[model samples]
Target: MKILLVLDNLSSSCGANVGIVYELARTWVERGHEVYCLTRKDRFHDIDQQKAGLLHMVWSFDVTEDDILNNVTKSDKWIHLSATGKAIFELTHPVFLQKMIDKKFCESSEIRNEYRKQIEKLFKERSFDAAVAVTEPFYIADALASAKVDTDKYVIMMDPYTNNPSTTDRTRKKKLAREQHVFESARKVFTLDFVGNDMNYLSEELLGKRVNFCVPKVKKCGAGRSDDGATVVDSEKIDFVYVGQLYEDIRNPELMLKIFTRLPDNYILHFYGGGCEQIVDKYKEILGDRLVIHGWVSSDESALAQQNAHILINMNNSIKNMLPSKLIEYINTGKPILNICQIQDCPSIPYIQKYPMAVNIMPMDNDNNIVTAMISDRDLETMAMEVQAFTENYQGKIVEHDVIENIYSDCISENVADMMLEEMQK
Candidate 1:
């Protein structure tokens, strides 16, 4: 089988999109199928001779000047647009502002025309069995749809399209209508959704479209490295560790900061991620030594830090459609999980509610001023004891054995491979 794998920014170890695409590519290639990567940029350029031989780069991506692997198969046309010129137009009107920030970088007519040309040419050259595209940029899916490519098209919605929180109200109906057309050619729609059951990645299925949500295989890891002696947390203090980027517009920590003030002196906060300085500075000033902020660290180090934490803190993002990848990592630790939910029916709540050691700080009606968890009361003293019981309990004492065991097993899902393979066989 020959397959097309599309990525906006290609890297082996970067974003969730990259992880899924690379994993699928490697899986298919190992199974003796040829997989071609179509993308805008290649951060690593570490593709070996053997793998590069089986892969092709499509469209207007300048992978690297050093790549003599000659991954290009049929992308001959290129159209570049200047964001500098568009910057002035962005402030002129609401319409211009929407255009400036809307969807992706590949919205230009020249680029779309070039895509149509290259797409047709590429299909003419190679007999591809299937094409898989993931969204965020959405243009790759857009391009595939626009080209009307006669292949088994598969769209993996890494994030929602019209259902996205930031999508303008004016464009909602048009975008929703386009959603059906964009994925009209898709043989099977797949989603890397952490939330379970009956939910389409796109909230409403226009024509009652059926979406195939699949959980990928999570490789087992050895117990995380512990007892470094050198520490971010005192080990004496009750540590609440959060490991991921805290975006200002998306996943703000302001509410969490407010909650932090109510905690006891022994509880300290440790955050690990980058560009978080702006968002953390005000709160960090108040907390002082209580808040420990580390620059972005490697995945291994982040996991190690989480392993040492008394409670792994999960923050709800502003967007309801997407689930944080770190939440999945936290659940696997079998550690006490403190999930903060600011939204109604947060995606994380469903996953963690069943775990004995997990507690959800759910949103409340601020009329009376209170924050409630899965436990009985939301008072300061009640919250303190609940935190203590979960964090200070004996090794494995707080964790429900049945729940933890089930979670561990559920991580390795054959559903993804089975569904995708079934599509390929068809």
Candidate 2:
């Protein structure tokens, strides 16, 4: 069976879309099925294309800053001749929308039309047994619809459209229309987390569509070096680490800075990844020698950094269900988990809290209480043991491979159905 995976920016490691595509495709390839990645040509699009061992095709479209700002209207009156052209221009080109909210440009008709045109052209040459459309937004769904794919299509829903508080008014309308199309048109819907049920409610209210939920597999890092040859700092001189975007809204790295700064001189904090560099720089100025901001470590190096750290920190203010894909890699490393974000009601949160090595922190004084629960020596010892146990369990876990293999098996089973249906005509 051939499976087609479609996404806008398919190369991003930080984004959920690429993570799902890579994990699913890796599993599909291992199971001996052909996998194709269809995405728009963009900055990060080429990064993992070859690594995935999947066919890569890009829709011919380039969105520049000039196209985003609706500046075309200022230069040429012809673009405003019809509402469709204006709306299409505004939706596909997102320079203006970013000014409103740091949002993606997949809402535009121009982008959708390009996706549709390219996909249709590809379909004329190659047919797929099944397709998985990830991150249901307006333009992607519209493109799928324009390509006229049938009801057996599957779409992985991340968060519903309304949950994005930063959505622009124009984007909101376009999102509503496209989301409706996805729910009504796609054969099935799979959500990474439990948020899809909420999305289904919104979908039924807006588009009269029903959605299904499936737990997406958590990802593990490519194996890292054992700490054998690495210099093991004395227990008192251990380092803690935090990786990924650090900003005020989702991850308050500032708060982490305050807590780690107050720690005795023996402790160190290594910061990796990009975004809010100034914020991190401010901490480096204050914490000086205690804090090291490495800024954007390579994938392999970052995994090594996680292994070297005495403790690895993962925190986010997004809804509890908003699991950072990196957390899975963090878990696989078997380091002590210091989770700053906690929700008692979320399904996954309970498992994390149950881990004897996990420290679930909540605000004790104000909105973000810098003071976290005490990390006693006994707790650290227990955590170290848990880390060892976790690493062993995750080391080449057949279950992770199994989940993906099952999804591929499900995809290939359709080939059997196709054969059965053809035989029935006999």
Candidate 3:
């Protein structure tokens, strides 16, 4: 099958959405299917095409940051209007109305009109067996609608609609409304979380479309295991590593600093990836030489850090049903993990809770409780064994080629008749 995947951007090693796209596209090509990934260009100009191991063609649409914010509401000040517009601009760029709205100031109709024209042009240029849209609010709605995709096209929405707490209510509602409009016409919608956890509230509440939950496969790294469950990181110093963005959502650097401050003089804590500016600055002062911030390393670097650390820490304000994709990398490292989050049944929590090497702590737990657990000693070998077993089990489940074949094939079969009729009638 020939598939066209549309996403926000494929530049960063930021989240699971891009990771899943990379894995899926690469696997499809390896299986001899023609895969074309359509995405926007980021600061890293060649990022989309440079995603290695994926034997697929990538096309970066020429849409500027200014294009997205041109006519958006001033009242919606809380949301990143420019960022939100950029997400949709790629697919709607060529349309004159959208162009006018993008370059000048026009009403929503003019913007959407131009957007529809560009979408139609995209459809005219290439015929895809399926179209997979990664999640956001309604990032793909106009594109999908304009594509006039025959029902056989797949619409995979990675996020539950209106779920970002940081977004403004107006933007969230608009995104949700767009999602519902698309859902009513789509054959199926996909999400990364368990069934009940996606952003398709209207699909369930009104349209009665129960979402298809697809578990994302972490990239296959031949991570080894130890029989006695003991592995050593031959480092000059004992290191505790936290691999996540410096963002408020996950890093929680302030809390991390407070927790690690109680540790002995020899132990060091390292930060990788980006996040909170103030917190990073404050930690630099107190920890002095003890804290190291590597700010945005490659996946290989992150993996190396995992292997080198005595313990890997994942701090989140809440976990709920969502699993931080980074947890999968930690699993691959076969190292002990210390998870700090609020939810009990988070995707990572259950797996980690069962393992001897994992210590899952909630925010409600006082500082002393966490400090005591961290200071306490345990059979490192036994813990390593548990981590090894968990990783092996997960890796065993992912058959890359098979997953791609099945998902795309299903996309083709599921909507053929409906899509054909819709397209032909038009």
Candidate 4:
């Protein structure tokens, strides 16, 4: 069997989507199937280099950052008339610029034509048995749909539809129409989380079939090790680690700041990913050295940090429908988790509850009101105590590598690959 995966970016390490794509390609290659990946030329080269053997072909377009930027500005002009459009431009103009830039580039007719021509060339080289289009930027899938590829095409929707703050009603309608077109054109649609169930209704309305659900899995990057060659459990400070971006709206760290500042001196909060500069700057005086910011580290370094930390922290405030990919990595560490999720029915709640060492705290004041009625100091102290107790309970217990592997294996890419193969056969 031959498979083609279309994506925007494929980083060398530390992304759940990239990990899934690599694992799927790996699984197919191990099974003697041919796998080809097509992404933008500007994507991290290390990813393609690292998986050279597994991927039969790693094709990239001549699209550059400047090209994407220029296209984004052109696209922005189309939406400039509306208040939402102006707000979207201002909010994401420079800081969160990738979202709009990628969207515009993907939706460009000229770009799609170029992609279609290249895809046609590839199709001429070898007949692809199936193609998986990850829905984001939504351009590759749209291009594939327009090209009328004969193979079994599958669309994987990783995120639910949220009304874009910067989009006009007309733009929103067009986006939805394009998504519906992609869904209607696919052999089958798949989602990484149960939140896609809500999209099932839309799929049924458009294509008379519901979307399928699959668990998003992470690759077993080896456990993180300390420089001094000692286990994290033996460390003097009780490390509470958080990895990934700290978007102000979605996954805010303000409440965590409130809790961390009040914690005992022995307890330190370490941030491993980017996008928390504002929070770090605001609390720099009070946090002092207790808050350690490691900016962005390699995948190995992140795994090592997770392995060393006394507790893994997840902050899911108000963001619904998507599961945090970092949770899989945290679980792999076999350390106690401190999940502060305000959403009552967050999909991660059940998983956290399943793990004995994990503590899920849904603060009473979780509404959009961040200023008023925040997580009280009393509750913060109580939660800190609970976290300490949870950590102490698993201090000496060694969770074998195999145990962690088994937990992740259930959702491994092999399972998803096999499922896709079965769907293709049908």
Best by lDDT: 4
**Model 3 collision count:** 11
Rank by TM-score (best first): 4, 1, 2, 3
The local lDDT score (0 to 100) that residue 217 gets in candidate 4 is: 59
lDDT of 1 by residue, 163-194 (tens): 76666878667676666776676766665553
TM-score of each prediction: 0.74, 0.69, 0.68, 0.81
Clashes of 4: 2
lDDT winner between candidates 2 and 4: 4
Off by over 4 Å in 4: 43-47, 65-113, 162-170, 200-211, 218-232, 367-373, 395-398, 401-409
lDDT of 3 by residue, 195-311 (tens): 246444564453444344434443332313122334444345566688886555533556556555655555677888765756677878988889998877877777677766777
List pairs with backbone clashes in candidate 2. Answer: 68-95, 91-108, 92-108
Better of 1 and 3 by TM-score: 1
Q: Please report the candidate that would top TM-score against the real structure.
A: 4
The 10-residue segment of model 4 with minimum total lDDT is 221-230
Judged by whole-model lDDT over C-alpha atoms, candidate 1 comes out at 0.60
Worst 10 residues of 1 by lDDT: 72-81
Judge candidate 2 at residue 52 and give its lDDT.
Answer: 43
